[model samples]
Target: MSSALEVGDIFRRHGPAYVHAHDGHLGRVERRVMSAIELCRTAALGGHIEGCQACGTVRVAYNSCRNRHCPKCQGAAARDWLEARAGDLLPVPYFHVVFTLPAEIASIAFQNKTIVYAILFRTAAETLRLVAADPKHLGAGIGLIAVLHSWGQTLSYHPHLHCIVPGGGPSSDGTRWIACRPNFFLPFRVLSRLFRRLFLQALRTAFEAGQLQFFGDIAERADPQAFARLLTSAGRQDWVVYAKPPFGGPEQVLAYLSRYTHRVAIANSRLVSIADGKVTFRWRDYRHGRRPRAMTLEVGEFIRRFLLHTVPDGFHRIRHYGFLANGQRAARLAACRVMLAAQVPKAEGRAEPMAKVAPTPRPCPCCGRPMVTIAIWYHGQAPPGGPFWNDST
Candidate 1:
């Protein structure tokens, strides 16, 4: 019925649209985020670009866009991010818990953004902590990390959190560490019910506190009665609470976390066909066999979908709580690492494995010594046709 869309057409139209729309409003905070995305790995960002002096193998000095949202820049970020976390991992089987918001709540989230999203994180974390503390499960305090992913494989807004936690936690007295059974984790049904109730309760609180702003299709819910109705409907629905089996060990958990943290909506290589102003890309249909599937959308529609993931200003998508709290974390982590290492057998000789760093390409226009990093370039300040993230004034 309508004309098809090409990937190129979509890119040509909306590729720079975000750049323009994001102007000045990004301000100081957003500029820092954009700088990490644009300046990463470009000569304009300035780096010690390596080049062979004799063979004329040249490399251009570059920087990296450290933006968590940039597809091209996330690999290195994940690697480095994992490295920092590796030291804190315990020598035990860790579980992966996924908490997903219902479609109705997701719709509301799209309208309110900052307020709803923050509540989503807090409520979910609270649910996990409360349920895990119950004597029926493992009556211990679990330390975990939660990362919020707001996009599905097709760049659609699907807000969810990926939580990696030790199967067991330390007891209330802090004397003996409790461990969950190797095979089974918490019951999903119980977790889901508790999660639903807690989330709704928190949502109602936010509404009364005037933290949530209703607009557009969601304006009807401004009335407390309407909002209560929406919550009731959502609460009855099966809120997704998926728990993955325990990982092999600490390294396995950290490796898995690397994939979810600092990821963009989609990778460039996954982009396949762009035809007639429509764009097609690969996606994994999780409802099925996790099979690879292709989806097509119009150029304008695609951009609209993509832009939905731009987070509210200064809101943290990745958060640590419980034992992972920022205050006294370093000291607590060091103590935990020491306690765990005492149980495991000592290493034979070599050091722990290192996460891989991305290879930075050097393009030497002037075949001389490796250019040293002098400065960095952010998005707005980038000169026309210059490095996207270079720090050229």
Candidate 2:
């Protein structure tokens, strides 16, 4: 793994040139993402020294950038996030639902990410809540943990929300648990139609309120008539809202979240090669039966596509709604458990137990004995150079 080519490797080698080429077009967030990935786990971030007491051996461990967009930093972040969410899992089947933006609206969303993405989340959640609340449908209030993914397999901008919804919800009176039929959740046709209507309506409202911006190919959308026409065109097409089969259990849900929640546009493991001013990476072609395929893009284009996914600073890409909303999550979940007669988690009554961020025993590579921290260093400090360092230059 150490020898593998990473997004960081590409950034370290070509990031400066890419930034220079883009110049005025590159935003501050994108520039920071590139710099963080490039410098992650390198001496520029500083680190510490661990010495094995039994083997009398020492090693240098560099610090991670801990930037959310850095590929190298997501593993620990995902693990920690999953640990916290573990207790929230109910003993009920969970369904994976996806709400996708149509191409025309996605083009607009690309320019006004903050505004449009917020609308996507709100309207998607609202559609599900409204549909499920109808007595003709589920007739219950459900909870959703929605995660936003903005890139397709080949790194194109494709904004969509992946929602993990429990298969059941509390009855409107909070008197009983309501579960969906086995292996089924909501009707996809109903969800798609409602999602389309709500999203188009919200988009039009944003345009009228002067919250959305248009540029380049879509500059004409700045006109009210043109924006109205765009919304009309979008409303005519069916929005894509797919409900995948219910998860086998809560474990499958956790595994899925661990993989998707903190994912960047691409993973380091997917890079096949970076050579000759081009980068080759593996991608799954869902259109072709999910077949694995290799795509080669010019180094600059690869950088451009990666930067396309850096969301605006401080904008949340993951959100909770309905019963799972942070504001009322605990009380609502307790009520749900009582109605379902599910055993209450012990940790909930006391302090929430967190996964240990660092393992206590840092075993020596030469011998299976615990290592102790001997020294520490911060950025800009001159790290000791010798056999002790782990080549974190």
Candidate 3:
């Protein structure tokens, strides 16, 4: 793992050149993301020292950039987030549903990210709620944990929502729990049609209100008639909404969330090589029987593809709706636990009973005992009064 290829390596080597070549074209957020990834986990951020007591083996570990887009920083963040969500898990099975934007809308989204992305979230959640609440459907208010992913396997601009929804929800009258069919949650055609209608309607409204902007090849869409034609074309095509079978249980749900919630466009393990001014990485071709394949791109083009995924600053990609909404989560969860006759987990920040299982400690490198932090080293500072003062040491 220590010698593995990483996105940071590619960035550290050629990111400056990439930035210099496309200086004015890069957005502020994209530039920041590049800088953060290039400098992450190096002396730029500083880190701490860990020592094993028995063997007295000391090692220096650099601080992570903690930028959300940095692949290296997402592991710990994902673990911490999963810990907090562990208590929020219900006993029921969970379903994985996906809502994808049409290619025409995706082009518009590239320019109007904040507005269009927010609309994607709102409209997707609304579609689920509306469909589930009707008598012809589940007739229950569903809860969803929606995560926004804006890139495909090959790092293309493909905006979609991956929703983890419970298999059941509270009855409209709040008297009992309402469950969907054992195998099926909701009809996919129904979800797709409603989602298409809601999303297109909201998009048109945003265009009419002068909230969307078009540029480059899509600049012609700035005209009201052209934009209307785009929407009409999208409405006529079938939008895709996919529903997978429910997960085995809550544990499986957590496993799924841990992977999807904090993932970047690519991970270090996927990188195959970088040489001759080209970067190579592995990607799965889902349309072609999920065959694994390698792709190579010029250094500048690789950076350009990466920058395309830089989300708007301060925009949240993960959101909860219905019972999981922040305002009413606690009360609603309590009600849900009571209705299901399941035990409510203890509140967060409280020490668990000793009888419960505790997390395993990180093993030491030399002697296999638990490693402990002895000191911290900040950027631009040397070790305090030590002969081992070299930056590389």
Q: Highest TM-score among the candidates is held by which one?
A: 2
Write down the RMSD of candidate 3 (Cα, Å).
4.2
Kindly state the number of residue pairs that clash in model 2: 0
lDDT, ranked from best to worst? 2, 3, 1
**Per-residue error (Å), model 2, residue 89:** 1.0
User: Candidate 3 lDDT (Cα, whole model)?
Assistant: 0.86
How far does residue 230 in candidate 2 sit from its true spot (Å)? 0.8
- Candidate 3 lDDT over 265-336, as tens digits, reads 888888889999999999999999999998999988888888888899989999999999878898998898
Error of 3 at 296 (Å): 1.1
For each candidate, the alpha-carbon lDDT, in order, equals 0.71, 0.87, 0.86
Q: Which stretches of candidate 1 lie over 4 Å from their true place?
A: 1-13, 16-51, 334-343, 346-393
TM-score of each: 0.80, 0.94, 0.91
In the order shown, the candidates' Cα RMSDs to the true structure are 6.4, 3.8, 4.2
Off by over 4 Å in 3: 1-3, 52-56, 343-364, 368-374, 380-385, 388-393
1-393 per-residue lDDT for model 2 (tens digits): 234899999999999888888898988889899999998999888999888767678888999999998888999899888888887878788899999999988999899999999999999999888888888888999999999999999999999999999988988998998998898888889999989988888888888888888889999989988888887888888788898778877778888999999999999889999888999999999998999999999999999998889899999988999999999898998888888777645443322335566657778999888888878889888776545435441
Candidate 1 Cα deviation (angstroms), residue 327: 1.8
| Candidate 1 residue-wise lDDT, 1-393, digit = tens | 223323223444555665576564334543454445444555555454344544444344455555666666778778777777776666777788999998889988887778888888888788888888999887977777888888888888999888887777667876667788877778889889998898899888988998888877789999999988998888779999998877877767766887788877776677776667677788999889899998988765666676677777778888887777778676765555554453455352211546656766443456644433333445345523323233332
Deviation from native of the Cα of residue 378 in model 2, angstroms: 0.9
Better of 2 and 3 by lDDT: 2
